[model samples]
Target: MSKKGPRLGEPASLVRMRVVPIASVMFASALPLMLPMIANSPALPPLGLLFFLCWQLLRSEMWPVWIGLPLGLWDDMFSGMPFGTAAGLWTLASIAIDYSSQRIYWRGFFHDWAIAAFLVAIIQSLAALIAHPHAPMGRVLGLIVPQIVISALLVPLFMRLTGKFDNFRLKRR
Candidate 1:
């Protein structure tokens, strides 16, 4: 090891484990407020939230289920989704991701972004199914496909920027 107290990379590895967990909780709490802007934007998509969720999971930090439960409930209240529906789905997704963590190497940002896109698509489908069980599948697909693609494309850049933010304190220390 180098004589320096802890090299940049080493300190990052240590600090990330704690900091990421807390940040994820806060991010989830604040996410719903951003939905209106995202929903209204022609250029952006709903899956931006999923990108953040994916980052939270990939970091191998917090248990997303805990974050998801309350966050989803909060989303339901704000978004007018049936009570507990978003919470249930979010919690389930978080659990799924947590279980799959062992199989995936989340350090590859592109791969993580793809996964986020896939998850966003899945969420959209599930929400549509819950909200309108009678809606034609094609309509749901039409609504979701563009957003998923946009989210996939945007997630990597967002992840990079957010990852940079995570490094802010590390630079000073």
Candidate 2:
């Protein structure tokens, strides 16, 4: 007798369904930082960027370089930052990742984490500079250290969550 359950192939209607969750998750990750409590916190990590980078590194093929522009624009709108801040930074990051993937022949968890930390530091520093051009260097430097450290610390968790999302995306019905 034939099986009475879902067939072991791709779902016909999954095209739209798959895209929604990914974009939704990225948007959702940004929401927490917007809250007054976290927004005002001295060390609120950029969770949105964290998740985006984690997803990019985890599923390198899923996001082409051009995708960063729209995603960054989306982030800029919701983040209340300047128009091109996140857009430029995210686009740069994607291009950098693309270049690195082509240049580097070896990769591992440690390498990925180190790369993430460096990127988070650069992005956070630029974000701080863009957001507060008049602020003193010392003050901005102080705030940025904690933010970058916290964000980098969360890389493993982000990686785990991304792995779960990957499993969900690829699972057969």
Candidate 3:
């Protein structure tokens, strides 16, 4: 045999152990909802949800349709948006992504961004509704709109980072 250790375009024969993408996404989704020591204000935009959407949109194959259930459960535990709110929304988002992917023959970064913005806004709105069901419309809008805008603005940055992480995850050993 030749001295070449491995050939280009070859798959790894040995199974490479890597962190579960869903687990990381779920953890990221929980971070922004956590309470801080100072207790001054609500947590920053939901980084975890932003990260989740980035992962789903950028690397759809890595996540299954049912992935949302467990992840949503985890988010519910931390987000305080009622037990089933995140669960249902996240699962629905996953299904929506699946449907969109199937229907759209072509996609680009901007399209993905638009879809992400819409989804983030919707999810944030739902979370606020669940948290303050009896609150005035203006109050709810006041609560979640900023967070949605922040989340939408941060999507590109999160997508870039997730791309890097995905490259690492898929790299040949």
Score every model by TM-score: 0.67, 0.86, 0.86
Q: Write the per-residue lDDT of candidate 1 for residues 1-173, one digit (tens) a residue.
A: 55856555554455654575456545644556665554432234543255446556556454545666766776676555588877877777777677667776544656666667677778766876787678898876776677667766766666766666566634535
How far off is residue 120 in model 3, in Å?
0.5
lDDT by residue for model 2 (1-173), tens = 98777686647347643674466546754786557674453456777777778777776777778767877777787676798788899889888887887888777888788878889899889988899999999999887798788889989987888787677766655
Deviation from native of the Cα of residue 148 in model 3, angstroms? 0.9
Clashing pairs in 3: 28-48, 29-48
Clashes of each: 0, 0, 2
Each prediction's RMSD to truth: 5.4, 2.5, 2.9
Error of 1 at 113 (Å): 1.9
TM-score computed on alpha carbons, candidate 3: 0.86
Report lDDT per candidate: 0.62, 0.76, 0.77
Assess candidate 2 and give its TM-score to the true structure. 0.86
lDDT of 2: 0.76
Model 1: colliding residue pairs: none
Measured by TM-score, the strongest candidate is 2
